[model samples]
Target: MGRHETISRRQLVQVQDRFIAAWGQMGAAWGVSRTMAEVYALLYITAQPLNTDDVMDRLRISRGNASMSLRALAEWGLVSRAHKRGDRKEYFIAEQDVWALSRKVMRERLRREVLPLLATLHELRDATDNRTEQPAGAPLRLASDDEPAPADARKPVTAAEVRQLNDRIDSLLELVQTVDRLGERFVGSDGKGLRLAANMLSKII
Candidate 1:
């Protein structure tokens, strides 16, 4: 092998293992399977496309596991299926466009986490609106004039305090809405808006 044929030597195994494990952990935190993330990391770092057998061999995963991971990655738009002219076996490659990859990930995360969070916040804000009605979507009201707390059991909340709490919740809702809109622009703009915003923010900062 030439001096620059590949990475350094046997010692590099440690680095590769560490990177794969770290990537898997990160993916797990983001609601992805650990092995699937490790597989994607491997395909990302590898310049050439690899087949199921190759992935299984490299990752020490079973064939079923490798196929399932690859299929999931393709579904997520993070990996692409490939083919060779003379070979019949299916191969896979990772999406090299990091910006697109990041956008997809953020889009999914926002749908999974942020959207639900906003719903919950909206419900909370409505609850703070002093509406004591017990609807299906609305949160349960704590105290109301009709059903006041027992004397000396708990300190009665003042109207001023309620207004202050509503204001605070409103502030939070506004901030979250702003973030949701920005995220929509970033993910929906196909990288143009993201780059523009990042460049402008960098210059301003």
Candidate 2:
């Protein structure tokens, strides 16, 4: 019985190691650091909260790396800190609900990536409009009798080309705005909006 228990424990460790490695790779693919992903994976699989020292020892990482990773995870809402009575040390646990986890990740990405991109697109479109509104003629030159006058040499952008470019930019802007609106309607709030989104995704997937 002792040998069987030992073998089972070893197998469990190996399985957990595989999960940690795979989660790290997935995190890298999703633009998260490997260490942070591994730490989260470890916490996610565990039933109880773990302290910084436990994380460091289990992951074979330094104190600084473990601490920083934990902090980042906490900021992302993937992990939360726990306080045990009479224990001054902090322990961390992963958010276990799949829906909540997905919501947090999407919210962070939209804030960090999508909103900035939309702002940049707006700025670029405004600049393009301003450029297109400029007059197409060169300034009048004062001719001298001694020097032969030259023709206006500036080749300004044509109205048709500007209109075409503006249309394309407008189309792109509209597309982005549509996506932004959909995200807001679906994931921006809790309760009904989230349920609606989940239902829609269920049908589509």
Candidate 3:
């Protein structure tokens, strides 16, 4: 059979199903959980766009879970809702271009999750250091909580342990900086090597 005539709706479905599974496997390699990977894969397929109900039905996931996962996917910019003509409910579609998808995912992840965590780690490292070096009678406390112990009353974090944690945090901060730079480079142009480098770096994390 000719290529066009060989394709059937059933075959299309099977192809899409396989693609979804492959996308899920990629997600797993990036540290996304199995359920999250599956959710992402389903969104990555389906050319006509889909609503939450459709996703729930196709994936056999609960309504609430579908809603939550869709929200996350939207936040990641991997899936976005389609504004259809006269549509009353929300519908979603994936960004199909792989390079664009990777850039969007990297940007959002850096902004929403990685950046804040890096800031918090920096703050924690600073606080830990201040407690160690502060003169008697000062208090050390987390920003979110009251001072747990007075500087005079409590034992300070040891210099060795503090130095070790600081070193680890420094290394992590440097990695994030490198990722930021690479992300900038990728955003400028499609680079397969950048993605490969990112994948290798992620394994270290």
- Looking at candidate 2, the ten consecutive residues that score lowest on lDDT are 136-145
Q: Which candidate leads the pack in TM-score?
A: 2
> For this target, which candidate reaches the highest lDDT against the unseen true structure?
1
Where model 3 places Cα greater than 4 Å from the true spot, the runs are: 1-5, 29-36, 124-169, 184-205
Instruction: Name model 2 segments beyond 4 Å from true.
Output: 1-7, 130-154, 189-205
Compared with the true structure, what per-residue lDDT tens digits does model 3 show for residues 57-163? 98788999888888888877788787778978899887787778777777766676777877777777777566555677655556755646555846667879888
Residue pairs that clash (backbone atoms under 3 angstroms), model 1: none
Residue 91 lDDT (model 1): 90
Residue 2, model 3: lDDT of 50
Residues 1-205, candidate 2: write the lDDT tens digits.
3454445877887888899999999999997899999999999876579999999999999999999999999999999999999999999999987667777877787788789989877776665576555566733223345855466754788989888988988898899888777776556676456777678899999
- Candidate lDDT scores, in order, read 0.85, 0.84, 0.75
lDDT tens digits by residue: candidate 1, 1-205: 6575576666576777778889999999879999999998888876579999999998999999999999999988899998999999999999888888888877877898899989988877777685555576644664456965577858779989989988988999899899999899899987556778889999999
Off by over 4 Å in 1: 1-22, 25-33, 83-90, 130-156
lDDT for model 2 comes to: 0.84
State TM-scores per candidate.
Answer: 0.71, 0.76, 0.63
How high a TM-score does candidate 3 get?
A: 0.63
Cα RMSDs of all predictions?
A: 5.3, 8.4, 6.2
